[model samples]
Target chain A: MRSDAVLNEAVRGPSGPRKHRMLPSWVATTALLLPTYAWLTLAVLLPLLTMFVFSFMSATPMGKAPITFTLKHYRAFIDQPYLLNIGWTSLVIGFWTTLLCAIFGFLAAVALARATVGRMRETLLILILLPFWTNGLVRVFSWTMVLRENGFLDNVLHMVSADTGSISFLYTRYAIVLGLVHGYLPYMILTCYIALVTIDDAIIEAAASLGARWWTILFRILIPMAAPGLISGAVLTFVPVIGSFMEPRILGGKVGVTMGTVIEDQFTQAFNWPLGAALSFTLLAVVLAIFATFSGVLRRGAAA
Target chain B: MNNITRRNTLQLMSAGLIAGAGYSMFPRKAAAAGTITVLNWQGYGTDEAWSIKAFQESTGIEVVHDYYSSEAEMLTKLRTNPGAYDLVVLNAARCAQAMAEDLIAPIDYSKVPNISSVAENLRANENFNKDGKGYAVPWVWGLTALAMREGLPKADSYAVLGDPAYKNRVALQDDAVGVIAAAALLTGQDMNNPKDLDLVKETLKGFKPNVKLLWSTEDQWNKSFAAKEFDVAMYWSGGSVRSKRVSKLPVDFVVPKEGGIGWVDGLGIPASAPNAEGAHAFANWMIDPKFYVEWATKAGAPASSNVAAMEALPADDLSRQIHKPEYIATMSIMSALPDDRREAFNNLWQEVKAFYAE
Candidate 1:
């Protein structure tokens, strides 16, 4: 009878008499979460709130300019039609980069999952992640050595065919795509690898036994199983590629003016913080819209 | 303005820190004195180890430095951190803005004796002198001009940048103001406030066939040149000097017949300076002939504004040869541009770049 009473007390928390004496569960939870919430408020939310305010200002609140609120900055796209073209260019670049990463990354992850195992898989995983160790600027700069005229690619080509003309494509969109792919490919691989590793080996074996061809098993089974990873990787790659300036600036050369560079110019060169903030908010809005459109798929993927 | 690239600035900051730590081991009499902080571009003359060491030993005033990568950043630092900086380096084009904001104090010329030797025209330039009060001491000046490979024929005009013969072999600096100014010069208009911006845009767009690279940094320009990326580029006079003297790149700098876009940097005392006396002493030393010669010979530098400092250079210095005093008369010195005009220039340049991409 005494043990039963103890079990009852454990299930119902403290006995009724002592209930008021103990701290509330919500209070304890709030205490636990307070640090993280406080940190987020200070670091992320506060700056974002400040930028949001600045975006509506007539100009940067510097010097002796009398500050006034305005929506002219948000009307930038309507005022300057060229921004639409630049926005489209950024999207196109993002699309290509994401598609390329998905294809290459999915294949690499499949190879790691099926073709390799044990120590070999571990070593390959490390090798795949080695690029992250080097600086992004260094990686972008190294591409010039490989892609420029009379560079490594040209030198190797000349060795193969003495009369071969220069095939250097540095300062081109292709070069920008290549550098970006090199920089962000690891993200796609790691995410896909996580999704692919959890699939049962029996599923593939059963498909094979049921007269499924290699392509059939691959497309019908493997891809569906890896959809979550593919979506996640595409999101990761596309978001950053659209906002990237360094790759375009270094590799695309004269063709490098994107929304990213324009926004950068407003803050650093033009000293127009309001315009930059407005552009940034517009970009953020587009990003949010994308997430909203894909929310259903993302939710299903997360649940799976 | 001598704006170092962000990458170079970080490297310079670390290098400065290491040097600063090394200097502390051999503390001089100034070690115990009050510290006076200077605001400037990292690796600029103010933070040079040898000069800082010498200045400290002689004056018995500890000098520390803070750095900014861009003129905008420099202004932000001055505005946000009152009394944190005793001295700051301001571009002549920006001196008016700083003065209007009261970020800088009126420089007492009597305290800076070296001002007497500075070029009369630069000293009296309305950019630094506003309402008959000097705000900045003219420190160094340079111009943006054509830098061509050694074997190429000398380019006497900015039109060479668009010449069809040099198709896909021309590089342009990636600064909106500098590029627009060059185009304005080509179109026979005032560079600072061009009345015919559309004409200037057309002129810039015409160079699309020739522009292979739009280089932003000295390092990038050098590497691209070394890689045989382009034959000619719109490069800085100081950059050309360093390319030839330090990196040993085979390049020739020319002002062209239309003249280059000129810019002057000045040293100014901030309005909230705690060590105004120390700042004056440092400014005097900065423009001193002895210091200029050492800095020029050992380290590549922009042309000094001080006439005596320029004359004190060895007969064959690259900077002296490139930055001729007569060029100052022909060149259009950049002045304080209104915020709207600056934005317009940036937008025009962006539109022109998009056109080039097409």
Candidate 2:
């Protein structure tokens, strides 16, 4: 009976005999959070949901045509039979670009962390990251000026030998990979540098005191410790390079068909939005699978 | 005190986010009194010629301009944001598609009497009108012709594009339908619809080895061509002519013996136009002989749609090159493709692009 009196007092306020009660703390917290979460729901989540719905549609939602749901958009790869080839081409580009960036970036990070000190290291870091500040489309277009036939590269060669044939390497797979590596190398370097900088110098000194050579110290201690950073950088680079269309279009030219370009065609040229949405979901699935496969390393890196 | 500060900060952040989202959801527009908004390509305004400014001064309608790079981009904008634009410049082939989608409204010819002043060949062309009603006015036209570097043998046939001698020295337009249509022209088949997919595929494959680069943007075209990246390309008429005149290169534009594709850009009013009357006024003003003359002279393309306007311009090299009525007659005009045919051609083009080098 006393507990019932207390419940009545809590519901109707401590001093008043009225029946209205104050809202619970949890409800107040939710109310405070609603506007922010609602913004997110309206901006990002709603568009994703709309795209997911459109993927199952028969055509773009234009004109007075009847709307139907079908899986034919998803099955486009099977029907055309050549989309598989494009997918494989994209995979190949991603593999090469990632491998090159990993090798180049890890070395640059090592040099910055160990070799340089004070203002020298800071300047070098700025130099490495300078490209990231410029616009990517402009950077990609400029490479054409440097790599096209009778361009900067060929002119340099001409100075060395008067009768040399033009060593034009633009519009090839090599040029595409070169442009992509230039664009993404800074990302890998920044990631690996964060991991490398935290390594205690004492650990390296102790290994050297124990009769370990530079190669031994690097292979055994440095690499294994920076594995998480390397893995995360690779994941970031690989994901974007696989879905890249502009770099391949500018540099790879006629041989530049990839899943990204195909999806772009659906939206821009063919006016096939349903097929584009389905292909995007397929790409998203691939991205998710890659992250799931590497979540452990990412978690470790974050913790570090 | 700490708890109160934290709660205040959270509330402020939430308020800021809500405000931002609301602002983005309904973007603020300038006051709309006497404003005539036009959606068009980049070069058609007073920036390219003085006539547009002259028109605005005469009409007292404030001109607001928005630009798009491609027809598809224009279509998407029209679909998403209705009633925001008064006029849109679209390809002649897209008139039917726009009508069927109810994206544009029928034009009143009585208001735009300048329509009668255009050359009879271009006025009320089937592509711009339907069942005696007009929806679009022909503005500019050009051809996709063969372009080769100076001192090369004259390329009179479409077969020259596929020749192995120019291997690794050829560029094609990075367009799906245009590429396949050109290939169809090479085989002497129906340029609009090729019944035999396999035959077209085989024909395109033969040309693939020689085509080392495929360019899409005008910048890419200019930079690469200036650098001597390729010996020959499927070049746009106006750009190729400018390249020859400016750089004095042996850049030659030729109408291949097989045929070439002709494209016409036209101005139309959207169905949901807020200022349809102003749009008609602008359309009428655009096709006026004096304005056409100024546009053709400044923009460096012929005003074939307005015969009186073409005659007004001096008989110069650029005018003579683009104003050839006989050449225009030989050109195969583009038309809206049926859905089934469009799909088939798109698929075939994808196959050609994805072809792996052996």
Candidate 3:
């Protein structure tokens, strides 16, 4: 047939060039695309697959990697009451920290967006955002030095105590939360500012003429409009804060061990990488669930 | 000097030629032999005094050193794909566990005659050479003791943490061994008995009321203690010496009359190593009394295997160190207990963590 003649001609061509002609453009394009996909596959996907595989594995006697796969690690987590308790503890910390960051961030952003002439606002804004300019570890270290009883705050406290009798403020849960909020507050503020700066002043004026009180207008219109920003800010703040390793580590000391430290120990010094991976996966799953729920609600709210 | 001249010439050539030809043939006398890598703790090296610089100078066999922070971390490395490393430095307690699993090889002391100079007290330590044969050289030893801030109520023992005067001002090592040892010491129970897990749990809970902080990292220890965040800190001898070096305040290192953690970390070659000759040469050089004392002075970690070396240390405050021979005699060498005991430790550790986390 004519097809056989064409195949014969293709085969008859020099073998090196003929091989290239056999493949389609899409196939070549796919081959060209493969290195990038391969890089991601080797670097990210393979490890994630290993994590998924080992969540079903067990810790060996020598405290090395899992030699056999079983659901024991996951089952171990489910059966343990303390694990459930830790999960709840993480949720509580995440929810409260997010709430505080969102509230403070929204107010601060609005104040920054609306307040004073150009340079003053710029200077004040820089001062507000300066802490974020440092690495998170350094910032947390700065807080540790600041909040300790022997630190700068304590020096002030000692000056006060010299007048009074004494005071103690370190190693409380208050310090840990305070550290996390300060660390993550800037992101929340940025998110809120991006949302707030675009709103027309006329919206407020319209609400005012419609006989709505300022609080009512804020509650009914402003807050609802800013809801997306608030939600995004919550996600931004809570995700890192909840999974924090260093902040709670340095600041929390004895008074801390959120899900973050648990996961960290499982990997670094514990030699239980698989277990650590599982713990991280657990944290990630929770984060993803929150994101999904937030997005779902946002889509519905936007449609409304 | 001739080899050095050739090496300089090789350096000037193209990088590829240096890698391929000139350098390998030039070191015909010594560099013909390959390298020996030592995996040890950070403080084990001798840059200031207790460093490997002298050994390298004496032997001419290139020595490379790397460090790990914890015994568990070191064990993990040794167990899973021990890279080109020929030797590891580890505490005998951990070594017992590692050797039982055959992760490391027994050291032939005849190959390291300098090991014969290790103190008799150290030689007799059952933890290091339980079967009367040596697979390791006693490189260094130290204790975990309590260091307290000045002008605080006299903390003669760890039990003082429970004293109402020190409430909300106590720090404990966040490690399982330190935690358990402190518990055993405070409870007036037999320290070596390996009692029921619940008993250990109850004893540790008492210390919980006063201990506001638990430190796991060396940096955390240095910063927290220096800041005087706690009135009393349970600390290792190594960190205490370093803190004492730069501290403006008068810090007191105390080995409680009750007892403390005494440990001996030894240098041993892994069985899988091909360069046993290099390992032996390095081990012999390390156990020299002069070398041992040298590192202790510079690194601020006093050595346990060398009494003569300790006596030889010229640091004026060496006398102030809590490493009294009599006190060290009272200290029991820590050993890795059975698998069940480790599990018991973890279980109790979780309980302690839960109490504090809440």
Candidate 4:
């Protein structure tokens, strides 16, 4: 708080020769922020407020039907017992996806930071980010080609063995996890890379000089420094994965009823907007709680 | 000061040309009486570029189109924007709902002479006719049924989908209404409003061992089939046609002894249609034998409701071969569902899907 106050004073400039001709700093800041606030109010806040109102309604305000305010939609988890299972399934999927991404991504980031430098490091970083250039739906669909029965993987397996049955694991929860990890791994890598790259090489050399083995150095030194990045990456990944419908719907086949798909069904298939809004708010609350839990780590990561 | 140089002259000329081009590209405002707006699914019959051009050439009225992705969206568009749409395409199941909401007006069958050629069953379908007043003109119709791999024994019933012999080799549609309707038919109950939903649920649950995929889109179904995902699946008649004829997948559509789940789409004018006369004229043209033939042969469309239009197709046409008139009698046409029943179906389907995941 003291540092923040000092920074604010520094930004406002040394108050010693206040120019009467110039507008106040607060006015300038407000003027600069007004357009952004207006845009947010128009685009995000208004729609969210509308949906909040809708969530409390008994029915969608359509045709000539009179709408009444009701809280039945919020009782969805209790009223519909099956939703609890679906919500749990979504969390499980999110947990696995986030775990896999952190494992593979952190290792990749460490490799990029320590093993490569100059042009090679630049090239590796670009390669890591290449997935973001393509459409996410296209990437998920392509995984089907690689993972389906008698697909690229099975064919390769058949090439090695004369008589091998198909070993495809497509249309399963594993496939859903694989698709999500592939989609989110780049985010984990980028975050960890940013955090890891900032570490002074002298610190690592000093640990080596102290006769610490590679694993010890990694565990005691690098991991501690990179904890913020890992937390931020996990939060980023878990939040979206829980809400993702496309990866599960495409890869999971019959077993893809997540909270995302359930909410989508209310809006698109069932036309139960009130229920959809209620579910969305419930999901938002869950997401906000997650953010609150990780707020400290996220702030520290930003500071780093 | 008029100091006109060669560069300035050239710039002015190019600017004038660009302005002229932009002006020409902008759609001219036609007299309200001469223009009619239609609301339907994108790339459906109404918005076909060739057909719309032909329609404009034949009739003085111009055709513009707005699209809705879902039935609820169509109703919402109608409710919110009065006089915005002259005509809308509604499934027979949704016609009653639209009429109940007073979103659509009663059709004057006399104005649509070609509607006479529409198949008697479709023309007299109770979903479009209420209180002896026709709300919509039956346009095109199809069924949701089984599509099986070629060389497999022809499926004679929906029971074949639950056969454990094809374990992990059967696909089901990922829709509540269609899936429940199929299950209802399997359990010997009314597809629209089944009395024994428990039996229907049990029947669907029994298929879990054989259920490999619950496909939502035709493209996904085709890709999965091509990758040898499933041999037998619940698929659309129109999709089966496109699969065999266009995609060249080895699949045959079979309407079982119990019957396929039938759906009919009709053209209805909005209650507040600004140009009701033009809407009627366009509606008549849509059902016309000539227009139906062109659309079916060239663009690939659902079977026409007009018997004469069906007859106009060549003897060997796949659409004609598959969409048999006799099937209409055995089929169970979908009807408008009450909100509670609709919610129940959605909940049941979600539960069954969750069970599948388990």
> Candidate 1 vs candidate 3: which has greater DockQ?
1
lDDT of 3 by residue, A1-304 (tens): 9999989988887666546647788998999999999999999999899778766665533454336766655553665557666677777778888888988999998787766558987898889988688888887788877887667775787776666533445566676788888888988888877777667889988989989997897788777777767777887888888888777777788877777877776665344655677777877887888778777786755443
TM-score of each candidate structure, all chains considered together? 0.83, 0.77, 0.77, 0.83
- Candidate 1 lDDT over residue span B1-358, tens digit each: 2355432633544463433432333234433356789998777778777777877877787789998867778898999999999989888888888898899999998989999988877877788877899999999988899999998999889999999989999999888999999999998999999999999999999999999999888888999998888998999887888788768999999889898898888999999999998899889989999888877765556799998999899888888988888777678889878878988998898888888876
- Candidate 2 lDDT over A1-304, as tens digits, reads 9999989878986666353587887998999999999999999999999999999988788764678999988898789888877887788889999999999999999999999999999999998788789999899988888887778898899999969898878777888899999999998998899899989999999999999999999899888888778888998899989888888888888877888888888887787888889988988887788678878867885564
Question: For each model in turn, which proportion of the native inter-chain contacts is also found?
Answer: 0.76, 0.73, 0.56, 0.78
Report how far residue A129 has shifted in candidate 2, in Å: 1.2
Looking at candidate 3 chain B, the ten consecutive residues that score lowest on lDDT are B18-27
lDDT of 4 at A95: 91
Clashing residue pairs, candidate 1? none
Q: Per-residue alpha-carbon lDDT of model 2 for B1-358, expressed as tens digits?
A: 1112222332333333322221111122333248778887655432232444455556666777887765667888888999999999887778767877889988887878877756555555677777787788777666777888878997888788789889878888877677777888888887777767788889888887788777776556767777777888887776665566665556777777776777776789999999998888887777776766655544444335655566676776564554455555566767788766777877788788888322
After superposition, candidate 2 runs with Cα above 4 Å error: A1-44, A62-64, A290-304, B1-90, B97-125, B128-139, B245-249, B265-290, B299-302, B356-358
iRMSD (Å) of candidate 1?
A: 1.9
The candidates' DockQ values read 0.45, 0.30, 0.27, 0.39
After superposing candidate 3 on the true structure, give the runs of residues whose Cα lies further than 4 Å from its correct spot. Answer: A1-47, A60-66, A76-79, A116-127, A154-162, A165-168, A285-298, A302-304, B1-43, B46-88, B97-117, B151-157, B185-193, B269-285, B336-344
| lDDT (CA) per prediction | 0.86, 0.76, 0.69, 0.86
lDDT of 2: 0.76
